[model samples]
Target: AQRVTQPEKLLSVFKGAPVELKCNYSYSGSPELFWYVQYSRQRLQLLLRHISRESIKGFTADLNKGETSFHLKKPFAQEEDSAMYYCAPPFYGGATNKLIFGTGTLLAVQP
Candidate 1:
């Protein structure tokens, strides 16, 4: 079975502080990993991808194959960064582009 797990439902932190959102997964085959974030009341957008090896919005994620984990990290948290973050894994082959999402972690960046 393919599944994604976000350990923390909420992560509260101060502005300029570091933030880390934990994510774990279970899949028999190779799967793509992505971090989708929603800032404040904004719609969910792609933050980063493990395959790209690039950072977006000051956030980066590393996919640990052995650990079956892909954790999102940012050195400095901005008040504007306060949002709901969801870690997801897309189904490789299907009729539609459907992505399985985690419960999500609400990041509160207090100023």
Candidate 2:
């Protein structure tokens, strides 16, 4: 079965501390992986995709094909970075495309 797993439901850390949110997936074929974040009272936005290899808000994620993992990381987390992060993958059904999200991890950055 194809599935995305976020092992952490909540992560709390002080400002400037390093943060890591683990994500793992199981799929037979190549699948597009992404991270989506939603801040307080804000809409969800795409944070990064495995193919992009770009950092957003000082956060980066590297896809490890050998481990089937895509863990999000930030060297120095900020209070403003507190948000709910989700691991997503594109799901194709018939002729339509949809996103399958794992259980989100809520990051709480304390001052």
Candidate 3:
């Protein structure tokens, strides 16, 4: 079973429009969440963490324990923001801690 789930495979929005990427997680303990972003032909980079309570490049997410969700939101979408976003949380089940990432959501910012 996947520890994280990204409901939308692709979220399309026009320039200047708001965007939201939905994510849901299943875990027994309090899990810190991270959002990863991958731009065209670039390596995946850490976009933000829920614990920081800060926005990165106009994106922000709050960890909701009750709902087990960490939804990424941006007030305005830019064409440069088009990329793949992932919801990842560390998996402590094994001897080595690893990130368990969702399938990922593609954000398409259209002009």
TM-score of each: 0.93, 0.95, 0.93
Candidate 2 lands at a TM-score of: 0.95
Indicate which candidate wins on TM-score.
Answer: 2
Of the candidates numbered 1 and 2, which has the greater lDDT value? 2
User: Which candidate order results from sorting by TM-score in descending order?
Assistant: 2, 3, 1
User: Who wins the lDDT comparison?
Assistant: 2
Q: Local distance difference test, per candidate?
A: 0.91, 0.94, 0.93
lDDT of 1 by residue, 1-111 (tens): 778999999999999999999999998777689899888767889988899999888899998889999999999999988899999988866676578999999999999
Query: What's model 2's lDDT at 101?
Result: 92
Which tens-of-lDDT digit does each residue in 1-111 have in candidate 2?
Answer: 779999999999999999999999997788789999999999999999989899988999998889999999999999999999999988888998688899999999999
RMSD (Å) per prediction: 1.2, 1.0, 1.4
Which wins on TM-score, candidate 2 or candidate 3?
A: 2
lDDT, residue 27, model 1: 82
Q: What's the distance in Å from true for residue 72, model 3?
A: 0.1
Worst 10 residues of 2 by lDDT: 25-34
* Root mean square deviation (Cα) for candidate 3: 1.4
Q: What CA RMSD would candidate 2 show? A: 1.0
